[model samples]
Target chain A: MNVTDLCGLAPPEPLERILVWLDAAEPDEVATFRLPHVPYPLFDHLTLRPCCWDTTEQADGTALVRIVRQ
Target chain B: MINPEFSLPLAVPLRFFRTAPLWLLLAGVLFLLEPSTVLSSRHAPEALALTHALMLGFAGNIMLGALLQVAAVVAGVRAARAGLAGLMVWLGLQLGVALLVAGLWFMQPLLLQGAALSLSLTLLPLAGWLFVRLCRSPACDPTSTGLAFSVLALVTTVLLGSALVLVLTRGAALPFAALLRQHVLWGSAGWAGMLLTSVAVTVVPMFLVTPPWPAKLVRLLVPGTFLLLLAMLCWPVLMPLLVLPAAALVLPLWRLLQQSKRCVDPARWLWAWGGLNLLLVFGLSPWQAEDGILDAVVLGGQFLLGGLLPIFTAMLGKIIPFLLWLDYRRQRPLAGPLRHMGQLFPERWLKYLGWLALVAGLCWPWGGVAATAAGGVLLVYALLLLGMLRQACCKAVAALVV
Candidate 1:
């Protein structure tokens, strides 16, 4: 499911919150997670991380999980 | 990054020409009335009157009106009282200045007494109200900070003036000369110098499309200059402290010059001229005896007023045309290419005038009569600038209609 569908499934109160995170893989990168209802235009000029949902072990043997909004 | 909301007030943009003609007339009157006083005295009543005419009558009107207009334009808050507030301030200022000048010229105790009180009281509330309005606006910036300091300086200057009036009237109270010295410091350095510098910080960058001022310089250096002036006012013996702020100014000035893309503009050239005039003032700071002090004060005053102010006036000549064009274009869409500011005036003539004024100002101390003659030439130059401005405004309006 897309992030929007995931938001729809969640409680409305929690869906209204905005969550931000920094990517560990690229320390300089900033990520934001928001409800599907939020306007995309607001972030047009801004830098943001794409939402993902996966957990895997890299060739280096380090396990990684997709970060989600708290 | 181009914020339309950051525009200057409607009145501010036109003020240079509106007041320039009057200042030119006053310049003539000042020179004619007291040519001898130019290099021999620190405080002649006629000269003092002319000084106030330039400060309050000319510069004061333009600065205050422009500030009000700028605050409204930039902040997106219309003047609560609208045109009426502006009208009152202008009329009160003009009438007050006329009475004060007349009183000073005749040395009439009754006239000076009443005029001094009236002018002070009339302007005090207007300045106070403007300050309140600026503080409440969302567009408040460094320029506003300068205006606020200017208001404080005006208050100090006026109060000292009122005290001088009282000393003249009642002959009872603190030593008047000491108070007058403080008054001079507050009026010149605090009000005139600080306000001009503060506005220049923003204006020079915007006009030349220079890089943004370093954040530290804007936040620290500008306010530091004012603080030094304040210290000087409170402690006369600490007059030596003037050098501190004067030195601080060098960094921003250097940065401004380095950043400016349009080095050829005569207005930018005036910045150097004003700097030289200021340096001349500083150069004479070491004179010890009264006669030596008088000589320094006279020559310095000539450079500061006759030399530096005319250069500032020349810059305004350049600024007004572009402002007029912008205002006109905003009201109506243009179909073809727009003219640059240089096209609005006789650029060659302006350069010649600037050169003449600079040469005359530098030579005035050595040759008093010749300096006055140069002042006459400066007066004509000012009048010519006014005429050019008038033509530019007319052309812009016509273009907008077409």
Candidate 2:
């Protein structure tokens, strides 16, 4: 499992890091992303790629997204 | 696993984005030609044309495109053929806005009639489709709910506008003053204001990294504002109540700005400016109905241009560059060095334009030489933004080859 903690980062930085990670990952590799919010736009972006992600809201108002490159 | 339901093409919104600056430039030209129109009574023919140019041509274009994008993202509303719908709406707006502006500018009844027909045909079906989709959407979030109400307001606005056109063109014995007032209210506060608030609820937090607005307050805002508008319409004496929502938003915006951790960008400052001007609009609203035509015109200009212009300009600056970057990433492999958002468009240029727009909006109400000078400022601002957009697109396309 790969973890990319993206808390405190703004906008394109977080999105950019995730894409770079996703692009380099092997098939079926799972990655977890800790984000400032639920990242709905990321969900929209993921539709174009062969990836599945589940977002879980944390008690502290942040979000954890688990993504698997399929 | 979340189902990926939205796959709207970037081109869907890009077309509208590209076309909008031209309309703003056109409004600038009209203002330059007749500076008095900027501060003249709203009933003046040139003033009417100029208003439509900004409202229907510039702002309407941006909002329609944005609505499609936002609806897809927030509500998971998928269009059957987004490209085709986008094209149809784009063409309709081009034709309708041109005719409406020319018709009013020249005081031609026939052209006004045609403009009314075209705009109605284009906007009504689009609004209906969005409303239905929003109703059936699974997402019950505040953004989605607010979008739904805003669409309803848009429908009401368009209908009232069409009726006003008939009165103007066909001499339909309607109370022109009353109908025009209702049309402006529904269009300005009900449609544009509601939509801005809805977008802000999601955008401000996400982009600025500020604490989210209190959910309960966010939830109540759209419906509460809508009810206030309805009350104002039914009982004209309740006009002062308009200040409540404006005040609600201004306080929260001030709070959010203080809490934000993100580095300052043109968008944030523009939003602050927009919020401040919005308060001014509401503050000045009660006086509009009482005696001062000049005050009324200035208030109209402030609401239509000052109140929303900065916010829209800010969104354009933020959104376009990001969209360009996203498009480049989607089309290319990640092997090359990733392009940053700032590289697509210069941050300083946006900063400069933001200040310029502020100056233009401030001087616009003064009329005479000041307004004309402001018009020149707007012309330069539009040209700069248009150039930036073009350069950004060209750069993105160039990256495809490298």
Candidate 3:
């Protein structure tokens, strides 16, 4: 699935869940499913895929997470 | 909702250390000097210098630093360069203020204009940038909204400030006096007024353990105040038009007090009393007597800055201790948590000081002796606060060491 499919997921919390689904997909298929908008640095660092979510998503999300880069 | 304890961020502590004392000192000096020349002469240099001292030196620095720290914490945006930005702003502001004051005292209009313009220009972008970042933050609350309004006020402050400079330096063929009046109105009512109101809404309720006030007051009053101020700017001829908006803006605080839970937080009580008294003093002056305007202005300044601001300082006297205790307790949960808030500062002393200052201000209208007594009482209060701050710092240091 492309980033657009992920965008359609609507909320940030569910998007994390969807990332798991994508990760569980065949490696080749998952490799082909690029998150177009996410920076490569962030995409590579994430266990699944990273998405650019807005403030409304942040306010509505269940958990707060901070991504630390090494 | 997140634990209110953890809601306040680390930057706040740093800001408190840096900015709070400076404000107190400026407030003290203004109280002592009683610059009759500045007040009566309408000398641009004297008036502008005093204005900048209060606005930029005392109120602006504290508010800017505190707002940045609070906004970052509340908005959950780790300011990428807050430390450096803060330092730069502080240094530039201080240097600019020193030069501006010197220029004004010496009657060097060029230097005054240059310093004022430089200070405003340097700080404006930082304030604007900070506000934009805050707007993008995930957590937007009443405090944040109040801060956002303050930022807008800062912008207007800069624009009018620069205009004042141009008029002073080049003898610009514009209505300089008209512009100066507008600048004062916007700076005093828009910038200082809004920030103080916002702080009151968030802090008074928190300290009082009061039920949450409706956010509508903040939402309506902040923007409404700005819009009205903007309207006044457009029609300078309608100077009297300001009275309606100012009263309307102050109405929410009256309502908030009616609904406040802890009627006994001596500091908050004094603040409510002083604020209402000043409002009435100013509100009624238009009808009763023209000569009372100066007295009203002085009394209003005392109430707002002297009375209301100190209430917050006293509140901080409690808050800082509690925060220090919490910070320590987090490290060692069983170390016999630091003394209760009551033990940290002398509440009775604060109450006495508050009463003395209020009484003196009220009586000053009758006799100069009362005004002198008020100044002395205020000086004592300032020294007391300094002593408490020093003690708190020592305790905090001990906690860190242990």
Candidate 4:
């Protein structure tokens, strides 16, 4: 999980919006996010996946995620 | 620290993306001037040349360029020296396509042999390089594996294509029909189609605001496609099956787009058009058609509408705009205006291009004056697309400099 992964491809898909969410998210806290695209490695710089991280598919094909930070 | 090579300069893949439409332009002009030559039959030299121009010159260019971008962005790995590799392959393909098209048109054995040699040098090496880079990617995902398989397909296409060139030049003593079918199948459904389906999993979900592909489905699509291709060698009747997986994955995408609450888009239109054509053309065994002009039309129409044009249309309307804005943002980290794709280019023009591509795809099969008109229209479509892309580039640059 690296930030470089997030910076490589795709634009205009709420990437920046997700980053804003990450900025406001409580540090060392667990949260759930349903994003249109993977915000993992990009959010990994915040240590979002250092603990319990699970990704599953929604009926419409987006990712439903729960990250439990230590 | 990010590896310095993690991202190829924006210019690297964009060069191929920009250059692809030129091939379509050349194909349309060639078909227009030599309508009779192209309309005669599927076996006609002119028709063969035209197909090569659209297939290798146009489709191949986009596939290679996109992979370089996808590898770095999606898979978290980069092709070392992508710019140099892209340049060599670009020059080689241009020369090879020119020589091959001329050879097919003039029925010149020496030129055909030379074209084969040139393509071999370019495509084979590039495929190897790409395959290695994809394998080294940090992300172990379906897209990466599918890309590796697609490169293998490219290698296979080159080998068979070169052999066919030798056979055409009378340099080889072998049967032609079986080998030709194999070649077309591997190149179209295997290399191009596989790559398209693989990319669709991410591109459709991400850009279109549609549901992501079911993980189970995405994981098996590429490897299953390859196995089907391998089996086709033993059972020729399975040729139609080669297109089935791609059609299956994309058909649902169209339905998803229809049900999507996202705003209307020309890119969506192009993708839907492609999905429809894929079903119409490859839904059945094309070998069942009797030999004649109609058969030629069906085959060519299927690949053009079902495979190439629709794919490129989506790419142009959707991917290019995002790439442009991404580059612009890199320049203005703080005060840069974040513009949506519709702001960069009018959606009306793209929607028109979508219809134009659809009309041209449908019109290609009706030979004679209609075919000529179709070619002419396609040429216009290609030119307009190139113009719009260039404008996008210029605007992005202006924003950066200003």
Candidate 5:
């Protein structure tokens, strides 16, 4: 799994970058993103896309969101 | 289908943000009418009108709008019938504030009575609803805790304010001085102060790209500030201690701005102005006006215009554009190309507005020609702000149609 660290980038940048990455990924390819926190609003957008994702709280207070293109 | 549980409709928050500038415009008009009366004394009817125009009208609208959106994000739960509830709250506030301002300006007891009743009905229910929602939410983060406390503060402030109205208009024999002090304390430190600090925890890091607030500060700031407010209520001499929280909130922003990658962002300048205002407000104590240096009116202006308005204006600049971008992005399939937030609103406009607001706030304490000019400048600021939001909304709509 490829891991992307998006910890310090502000707002829509994090949401936008991850969506762009997801769009270009191969089907069934899984990627994990380390975010500053749980991307609540991004969940709204992901609901519309053909993707499956799960978020886990990391020990360091960041959120690790793993996404796989469906 | 988008989950209604997780999604907030665009119209809900937009209605509030768009209406905020109108209140500022009203404040400008009141100032223009009689700057001397406004600057004369804090207890003067004209001064009270101007204060309410900013507080209940401008700041109230913005804070409530922000609460609707932030509550959902931090709590991970959307309020039931949020749209309808928001609309009702907006309408009630608009009506209540108009009556309150008119009552103060005209000195009509009947209008004051109506204002008291309308505000109590609207704010109590609204606070109660949000408090219940925050309490039920599983996410117990600092931001959520702050939101809950701010709601309680709003309740205390409103009750005190209503009591004041009765004393003034209904001839109720209450301890007017003590009630007024408590009202100012909770309204400023409890309601407005707490909300700003709590919201900053989320907004500063997410929008400004600052490192998260210190973990210890995040946990203690809200609860600790509330305790101090309670302490001040019991012992008014501890009122000066409230400055500690103000300093704590401002110091981190200055520190972060020094390290922020988006150093030139206009919002950063406004934050600096907000910090400066906090210093001036605390340094020039209202009680120290006995030597004829300044009065409570100037202190009030420092707090509202310099301290609160800048922060609110800067946040609106970022939030309005971002919200428009979000809405446009959600419909980009039909809208064709999505415009970024910067494209929706120009940063230069915000920069200009910030400078103008600073000028207005600085001139507010002086009563004569300077204040008159400040009134004119504030009117322009309000119009420019309103124009920016309207244009952004139009751009989003036009793109969707195209």
Candidate 6:
């Protein structure tokens, strides 16, 4: 749910970049990111167990992310 | 503690998802078996029948079914009396669509009346229920906003469609072309496209590991597209340009997909095929600038590849496996190797299906023998998908029962 937890998962560089973006995503709009390979459990966690966000997939394997920070 | 509340039974959504391919196959058969009737004229009764199978039967069914999930998950709302509502809405939709297709194909007044009556009995209340839930949901993000508008467009699409049906019944020789254009504009662009855009903002990123649609585009794109479509009502020239922007969205996403690291995924390729089809719809605009059979072919390909089928293919890869996994996890109670979405239906098969879809898409508008060939390929694609899902269901059931 937090960046430190994501750091603990040690996602590859591509995914880490998405996490970094998610940290700074603007409100009420989508921020799409892509991964080279199917990511680890941490990416799945962010998708299914979003703390204050929603995750979607594009036609390709790119990730379209939106966060709702309280 | 992001424990999302499960709303409708997976059965409700799965039933609709599962039925989708069958209807499309029926569409293919209708298209193939009556190619002369269907390919010869855009206004042919047989042609309309083929379209209905795709529109009301295939696209509408999937969208409505997926709507329950989107409403529950994204909008923080649920269908009222989920079980009964699901059944009533599904039944009404299937029957109404069937009658309308029949009425149009045969030009039967009674069937048209029955179609209108069936939809009146079912679509209005169901749409209203969904509309209320979506409008009232606390989620105020772009996806939810787009969804709320999409539902409104659905209401308009249905009413306009009903009016057309009524016109058919009255035995009046009115210039229904304008009304028909309006109806298609709202139905596909306003309702279907809007909802697709809404879902894309959510599902595309989560599943494909892709970037979200730019917030500004998500905000301005959907509503702006719908309004422009509305403007096209008085100005028919707007027709060619309507879906161009929505389709243009693919190029940037295609660039992003080039950056995706998902090495073994077929979704990226399928999506690319879809985007290419959208581009082609406009790119080949000069061949049949006006509304001719060639133009119909281009539009048909856009809806099939760019619009509905590609997304359906991508979502099936996500949803069916997820549903089965959820059941396996919840119902098994014993320790076993749970299947990932990839394991249940491997990426290779998706790749194969993707190829078939591409071939079928190309063949779809060629007419005559080529159109039949497209149907053959599409039939295989649909059967493969449905068969895989059916196998997964059986496995899930076996696990649950034991």
Over 4 Å off in model 5, which ranges? A58-61, B1-4, B290-293, B333-336
lDDT of 4 by residue, B1-402 (tens): 223235456787788888888988998898888888677667888889988888877877787778777766666555567677668878898899989989998989999998999999988887887788778755566777888898899888889888898788875886688888889888878898788877777777666666556678788989999899889878987776755686667767777788544557677778877877766656654654554433755566556855568767877677677767665654554335555666576678788788888777777666567667778887898899889889888877877776
Clashing pairs in 5: none
After superposing candidate 6, which stretches have Cα over 4 Å from the reference?
A1-70, B1-6, B172-174, B282-293, B305-307, B332-336, B399-402
Model 6 Cα lDDT, one tens digit per residue, B247-339: 646776687567655645787877777767666664454355334445675466456655467767876776677656554544443334553
TM-score of chain B of each: 0.86, 0.96, 0.82, 0.94, 0.96, 0.91
Candidate 3 off by > 4 Å: A1-70, B1-39, B42-48, B237-263, B281-290, B293-308, B311-315, B322-336, B356-360, B363-369
- What are the TM-scores, per candidate, against the unseen true structure? 0.75, 0.93, 0.72, 0.86, 0.95, 0.81
Which sequence of candidate numbers ranks them by TM-score, best first?
Answer: 5, 2, 4, 6, 1, 3
Candidates in descending lDDT order: 5, 2, 4, 6, 1, 3
DockQ for every model comes to 0.02, 0.44, 0.03, 0.17, 0.45, 0.06
Expressed as tens digits, the lDDT of each residue in A1-70 for candidate 1 is: 2222222221211212222122223443323333222211112111233333333333321223333422
Worst 10 residues of 3 chain B by lDDT: B1-10
Report the lDDT tens digits of candidate 2 across residue range A1-70.
Answer: 5667786565677877888788778999998998865665676567767788897767544678998899
True contacts kept of 6: 0.00
Candidate 1: CAPRI quality band = incorrect
List the per-model TM-score of the A chain.
0.22, 0.90, 0.28, 0.45, 0.90, 0.41
DockQ for candidate 6, C-alpha atoms: 0.06
Highest TM-score against the true fold, candidate? 5
Tell me the number of clashing residue pairs for each predicted model.
2, 0, 0, 2, 0, 36
For model 1, residues B124-243, the per-residue Cα lDDT tens digits are 886687677667754435665666677777788888888988887778577888888778777766776666666665555555545555655555655776677667666677776665
Clashing pairs in 3: none
Candidate 2 residue lDDT tens string, B30-51: 9878876556666889988988
Tell me the lDDT of model 6 at B397: 70
* Native contacts kept, each candidate: 0.00, 0.39, 0.00, 0.17, 0.35, 0.00
Model 1: lDDT of residue B301: 50
Q: List the residue pairs that clash in candidate 2.
A: none
Best by DockQ: 5
